[model samples]
Target: MLRSKKGYATALLASSVFLGACASTSGLDGINDATINGSHAQAQGAMGAGAGAVTGAVIGNQMGSSKAGAAIGALVGGAAGYMRGRSLDIKAAQSVAYDARQAGYQAEVNTAVMQNPQTNQSQQVFTGYRVLIPASEIRNQDPEATRILQKTAELAIQADTEVVASGPANLRDSVLTMLNLPAGQAQYVPSNDTKVAVSVMPRRG
Candidate 1:
């Protein structure tokens, strides 16, 4: 009887710690930020942990050991998730590099700072400056402006294929006009300043 009670106590303690860690580390913000920033690792980790915890807890409970099951599940799930996430991140980085080259950028990996106007949160994304540069610059008549315009136009075409618009109302409108995109085709992303706009495209499965 004493041994059974001790086992129960240990399981309860393990379960509490597991639950607390999950609550503290992987909230909605963490998930949303990972997705927004293209941090496949973080996103995958969060997903794996959540799925693993649930599965482990269920199995453990069935075996009369809920706490231990949850703890084990979390560790196993996190590892698997990270591995999958790493694969996805690599593919995504390659795709971005390809897009940069096609858009007339240096074909190098670059980071852009993006802000969510609604949430007022900032995130770093992997993309070329052509997608992040100011529209006014692209509109100038200088030779540099011409080059920027061409690159922006390339991104605009991709955006037209399938992207939703978000960001400053005025900037979004200006981008639509500058790119000559039809109504509802612009994918204006929010930035720290009004002059710069950004767009993010979803990866198709």
Candidate 2:
């Protein structure tokens, strides 16, 4: 009986420490900053711990071991909460990157959804960018043109979009190769002229 009492006390002490740690790590100021910046993992972890404690306490009470139950629950819940929060952060970053690219390019970013014709079900296709690069720019090695193309590629990666280039056959082919895109995935426009236009489309699996 004495050993049981000691175990219960130990469990309660551990639970208190865990709760205290969470509170200190995720204070109100921290949470507010994370929410404003779209980085909520820390806040989510704290919230998860609190929620887990309550749930654990209830379950433990039913089982006559509330403290131990609460401690274990908090650990598990905190991990799951962090993952959910990280996912949200990634989505927010993608959105910001897409918007910035659109504004800088002064071109509308095109989005399309592809559907399975047989099943009549729709799947979201690649969010992509379409831009026209002049043939002269490529020939003269214009730094601004190069920067724009490079930035476009970077943004596509950040936003998880695909690239489509249509212009001088040679330029289009070179860009496609530089992107390491599969030949089968690229759609090239046939032109004997110097003007080149490229549109980055999302890769389909």
Candidate 3:
């Protein structure tokens, strides 16, 4: 009887230790971010760690030895965490960009493409620029937002005409107009994901 009690205690201790480690590491996995970003790809979660921990614990407890269960559980949990994290990160970036575009900024979504530079062999190239333009300048162009929109449309058309096709002036214009600056209102692009608004404390009436 005493031996059985001791074994139970040991199993409980081991499980607790494993769970504690999981909690600590899971935070770093960035699962929450991946889910929010909508870019997480769950590769091992479904079959690996998600199921492993539970199975590992149950089997280990019944068998009065947690080593087997803990190992399997760790493996499964790790994979799930990784996939979940990645997905959220992707989703977050997309969401931010999509909102900006809908509000009248010409937003673009693209990834690196491979093309040859000198040799015929393909080479990877980075795309997209995080540009910053003052809102005051945008407002001065045309309060109507027409000139900018038409310009962007034209740029896009021109790019399509090109064989390799990469025209960003229109894209730049769209972003500039999205600020919707009034007489004195101005904005600065602090980062790719954020914009800053600046205005004179005095009104020019």
**TM-scores of all candidate predictions against the true structure:** 0.34, 0.38, 0.28
Lowest-sum lDDT 10-residue window in model 1: 24-33
Query: Can you rank all candidates by TM-score, best first?
Result: 2, 1, 3
Per model, how many backbone clashes are there?
Answer: 0, 15, 21
lDDT of predicted model 3: 0.35
Which candidate ranks first by lDDT, i.e. highest?
2
TM-score of model 1 (CA atoms): 0.34
Model 1 alpha-carbon miss at residue 84, Å: 2.6
Model 2 Cα displacement at 71 (Å)?
28
Model 1 lDDT per residue over 92-194, tens place: 4445434444544433323333332112334343332224444455444335434443444444344222234334555655555555655554556655463
Off by over 4 Å in 2: 1-106, 112-126, 172-189
lDDT (0 to 1) per candidate: 0.45, 0.49, 0.35
Per-model root-mean-square deviation over C-alphas = 11.8, 15.1, 17.1
Mark the regions of model 3 whose C-alpha exceeds 4 Å error after superposition: 1-51, 58-65, 104-205
